[model samples]
Target chain A: MKILLYIILVTILLATSSARYGVVAQQSKVREYRIANEHRILEEFVTLLSIPNVASDHVNIRRNAALIIEMMRRRGLEPRLLEAGNSVPPAIYGEWKVPGATRTIILYAHYDGQPTDPKQWAGTMPWQPTLRSAALEAGGTILSMPKPGEKIDPEWRLYARSASDDKAGVMAILTAVDALKAQGIAPTSNVKFFFEGEEEAGSSHLGDIIRDQKLLEADAWLICDGPVHQSGLKQVVFGVRGDTNVDLTVYGAKRPLHSGHYGNWSPNPGLILAKLLSSMKDEAGRVTIAGWYDDVAPLGETERRAIEEAPHYDNELKTQLGLARTENAGKSLLELINEPSLNINGMSSGDVGALARNVIPTTASAVLDLRLVKGT
Target chain B: MKILLYIILVTILLATSSARYGVVAQQSKVREYRIANEHRILEEFVTLLSIPNVASDHVNIRRNAALIIEMMRRRGLEPRLLEAGNSVPPAIYGEWKVPGATRTIILYAHYDGQPTDPKQWAGTMPWQPTLRSAALEAGGTILSMPKPGEKIDPEWRLYARSASDDKAGVMAILTAVDALKAQGIAPTSNVKFFFEGEEEAGSSHLGDIIRDQKLLEADAWLICDGPVHQSGLKQVVFGVRGDTNVDLTVYGAKRPLHSGHYGNWSPNPGLILAKLLSSMKDEAGRVTIAGWYDDVAPLGETERRAIEEAPHYDNELKTQLGLARTENAGKSLLELINEPSLNINGMSSGDVGALARNVIPTTASAVLDLRLVKGT
Candidate 1:
């Protein structure tokens, strides 16, 4: 009993000491980071945004690659241009080594944006940055609209093609490193940057480039390619679900048949495909595949604990998503992202628009994405 | 023990007698169906084929409806047209009472063909019917192709919008009744023909018509729709899965943003929608919806036994369908078809074809069909 009382006393003392240390650290937090060179980072971002780096547009892509190389060299980093034959645009690689750092981090960001249809955009062109009031969770910073007359405030975030997806991520990383440099606090670890022009095109030749480049090696890979949490809190993703694209085609008759004339007699590929898809999972969302669950890796205790610990709003989410009720396994957001998944990305065949055509489509195809976790 | 033995013997004897009867019935199956007048049937089918009843074209739809009414009148059957105001073409109801019939059977079919994109059909006109040789399960059958003057034949079936669909089914039903008249063999059951016009439009107003019409009343409804089995065997369908269409839309921003710039920070509605869809199903094809199966009815013992008794070629079917394995229940076809289903019919938001787009889709939508069984 005396030993137990003494241990409790020590625990309380340690807890008090820890709390005090945390308070001191919070009080010493820096208010401003590199004010003298703040405009320079913004200038570099605008410069990168100025170039049109739409996917498969080789000329602009090459120009952007050169510009990125120049930016890296200006920061005293060794940057190189790597090519992957003719089909894919070239990639840019840069490395900054800390004198005594053993660990290295690789930052990946794509520079290209989807080709824009001017009519679909709200402004004159997609290449120009537009700014507007966006939700805090969606990047937080306010920005200007891309219209010709729209003026941008220095404090405002820029909105443009290739602006947020990856380019913004690229700029943020660069700025973070630059801020550290201004404080005379060099990176605590070796850092590498890989900017690719073909990520939008499924990163067609990225694996090849990664395989060939010795300098691109890293202890950790940080993919700047997804959204921040909906709560506006930044998260460190330990891993991501790898994806493979599946194009499924169901062939019916050689031509589109009238659903009316063939309603009961001719094959309806749409209905057949639907049945086939539904068969995979029961109404309860349980997969009915033979031996499908056998190979799946069970959730780890850590992941389970995280899921239980996380704040959840399943009921609210269901209402917001216009769902009558939350889906199975949707009780936790972590489970929704961590689990293996199959999605019917797109489905097409026959007439399914304004004017309904009673067509038994000859061929029905569904574009699907299967997200596989590390285990299965 | 003696009584048990006697019961077993009696059961064996009864089973043997029933088996013998089944074999005899199978061996001496009905070989032919006679039409009242083959020439008239063919001529009418040909005339109906010539009328271009393209969907959404009201003038053509009305013309076809008139022809159907005229045919019923010529056959000495009293027919009435029920038009759903502000809706598509009207439904045609024909009734004939066979003297001394104890039961009633309703024949349901639609009269509509898919609209033709002239560019799709080469050297063939949508309205013209041409004689062609099509290999049949019973051998080769000379049938009519969509366009006139084409002599080429395809194996296993003729290719026309309405050939094997309801139009042909309608012809089959009409020919059967006509045969009864010619042979002086009155139908054992009262005949009610409900030929619908808007069946091609999801038979949208048929429910209202069924509720409103007294003349169209019947003990049982025989939907002469869809197709015969792939094996070309006659099938009696007692049930069909009912469907509900749901359209989903997800909004990320007021406008599409460049994926490169906002890829990781701003919400990509396309990606969000894709992730949501993916979450609904897993790699083995399971829906992940929470209450998706709340009202699902389980298969009964009799249904399970029927499934076991049903003939199936799972391996052959998998190979023929180019599937590694069956998706749905992964059970027998009978078992699989006995359940409800959810299918992604169409999904669209951004550019879907040709090359991949890297922009964060501002909005995305998917059309889904949820199929329900009898109880659900």
Candidate 2:
């Protein structure tokens, strides 16, 4: 149960469509090797998923790291936590040294997840991983835990906070290591595992931990994050855009005032915010803020060529997202993402809907997410 | 105490600077008549203010009406409830017929107040009116209710939901009657009182009640609402601007998505809202929307002359409100108020401040207040 839960559920989720659907037409190596031992991997994955892993959740985050450490211990990998501070989410580190391996590579993944309002998730909680017969949008049905002899459908999805994120990356890499040892395959390279606890939290302490810990040294590192491709094919991302957040606030009168009494006189914070935010973007969705796009580096020939060669799925994506249009007018999604971008993640002022009142709010605030390309 | 509480406080609040502060230099009619009976009026005002009188709160709204009904009964005026519907806030109606009166005037005011969020009120609750030595922004000190014989500070300010709004209007009109009876003065007008319970809620049922109740007949409806001139002088306003509210909302992807993953590819609702709202107003804060100002009636020579003659206190108001700028670049406050105006009372999308997350919200909304001049 432990073996199959850890190996099959999470690891199989993000595998290429070829690997995922190959079982229906013909048995893949994973099916052949684990056909009789499927329940073990399913159980191990479920147990690990049970722990809450929001980066901001100090207690539950540590609990998740502890469980990963124990899992590494059972596999004869001496895992140690590399932390910059007691409160910071630690980076769990371990390595397998091959007898005559010359190349050293580090497999990197984050155990932490984006902060979530649990109410946003439907039919499930962030930590309470559940198996669905299909995607929720496609009319999925919840399924109970399969007994040892029960059939496990490969198309069934596990819905949870970190299901498709780097948590699945952690399990996939670990399972790969397990498969190598089980097949008595000798390693061609020295393998090191580094599981980060705060990638979703901006990885603020990641550099500090890497600088402090000597064991994290590697010739090359492959970060397992983000998505594959919209076509369900695997794509190795070379570099990710840098991210930063800005919290902007504007003020009105010292107190909430009747809009009718002061509508033409008092400056409303919400109107001020709208004007200010609008000033940052033009009609074509290009940021109008001064110096916004001035610092971004130009894309090189090789990088531009790679983007041109990538799949063109903007039209398909727009249809799926129910959007008749997207930002940056003529630019494709691939090309647009390569440049620096600004997006308003959230905004708030006074109240709306049921609690709406005819009064000018005291203040208005917005959370802006800025994504940067190279050199930006 | 009973007589003073109802008369001195609310009646004196908006009675011009002369009536409010004339006691030290010269005793006004209100002060001279209510000197020994001051606490009675205050207690009554505070007790009425204590009731939750938001129009939407049906249960508490009726409680407010019942209290007002009893207050009128004790004053020897016959009061009756005028309701168009069962759930609608009832209008408290009463009248006094002076035998030799020629002019008949309906003293119109609203008892219901703007919906309040308690968190916005500082150092006090909306329903718990408190005595303050000065305005809250002026570092006012909270004071206990003055005893009957104790001196009442004519300058002291009362803080609560409807303390300065139409509720104060209700008490003022009623107290004027009390003052007449106590002083044995015969009023020259047949006075009628129509205290509406939902003016702040747009008075949807106001026309309905007035049409149905034959007792509401009067030569003129003197609406005891809004404020005095900015110079703290009484100004008899002729006609008021009409008001309407629009709840505007924009949609995004059906669910919240990780901004870093989908930001550039997906359109953000907040940015959409910002751009949309900004299009409705220009840099000079003039409405840019098509036909927004086309229907507004042109001001006549009399109205324009009145605006020109009004005291110019824009600079003083700006300094007091901590504003370095005002809307409609060249327009004065008096001139702007005479025209139509649009204000964003509140706006919201996802969360801000502490609960802010790195997710693209599913929707963004704003409450727009449109105040129209005559013919609009």
Write down the DockQ of candidate 1. Answer: 0.05
Best by TM-score: 2
- Candidate 1, true inter-chain contacts retained: 0.05
Kindly list the per-residue Cα lDDT of model 2 for residues B220-289, writing each as its tens digit: 7777776765566556677788889999999988667767667766778998898888788877778888
CA deviation > 4 Å runs, candidate 1: A1-60, A113-128, A135-159, A313-320, B1-376
Model 1, range A190-296, lDDT digits (tens) per residue? 87888888776667798888788788777877776665543433344567666666666777655544332233333445545555555555443444667655666
Interface RMSD of 1: 8.1
**Chain A TM-scores, one per candidate?**
0.77, 0.89
DockQ of each candidate relative to the true complex: 0.05, 0.55
Superposed by TM-score, candidate 2 places the C-alpha of residue B100 at a distance from the truth, in angstroms, of 2.0
Q: After TM-score superposition, what is the CA distance of residue B268 in candidate 2 from its true location, in Å?
A: 1.9
